[model samples]
Target: MKAEFVCTDCRKQFIAEGIKNEYTDPVYGPCVIYTAECPLCGGEGREYSPNQGGDDHEHGMGPSCPSGGCCPGCGGM
Candidate 1:
């Protein structure tokens, strides 16, 4: 399946195909998840929900940098 993902290290966003893996989570119990790698950063990527803007911050990040990336508070841009 295809899903949106954000790199945990570099915070790059991209879409990639992944295979569903069935596993049991200690808190959520049995669950299915997709895993993929960031082609740009080669870092592990996590699925991102569309409902959550684009930034990963829970309360939202500060202003955007001149380059169109997150502010320095998030170590972005």
Candidate 2:
């Protein structure tokens, strides 16, 4: 699924595409989550809705450094 988010740091908006994975959260029981990184900022974006359930919750990291794409999410690995 795809969603839009505004980077808190850069104040810019971007889209993120992610794959869904389901797992047992122990406390939450069955949980479905989508994880994706912002293309423009390479930030870790996360979103979820309790009412929707099994729905898309978008998330993003932060501004990216072009040198090595090093950020909290990618770690420049």
Per-model TM-score versus the true fold: 0.58, 0.42
Candidate 1 segments exceeding 4 Å error? 50-77
Runs of candidate 2 with Cα error greater than 4 angstroms are 5-13, 48-77
Error of 2 at 15 (Å): 2.0
Lowest-lDDT window of 10 residues in candidate 2? 53-62
Residue by residue across 1-77, what tens digits does model 2's lDDT show?
A: 88654444444556677657789998989998665665667765454333232212221222334444454554544
Candidate 1 local distance difference test against the native? 0.70
lDDT of 1 by residue, 1-77 (tens): 89888777887888998657899999999998776799997888778765445554422343334334555564553
TM-score of 1: 0.58
RMSD of each: 7.7, 14.0
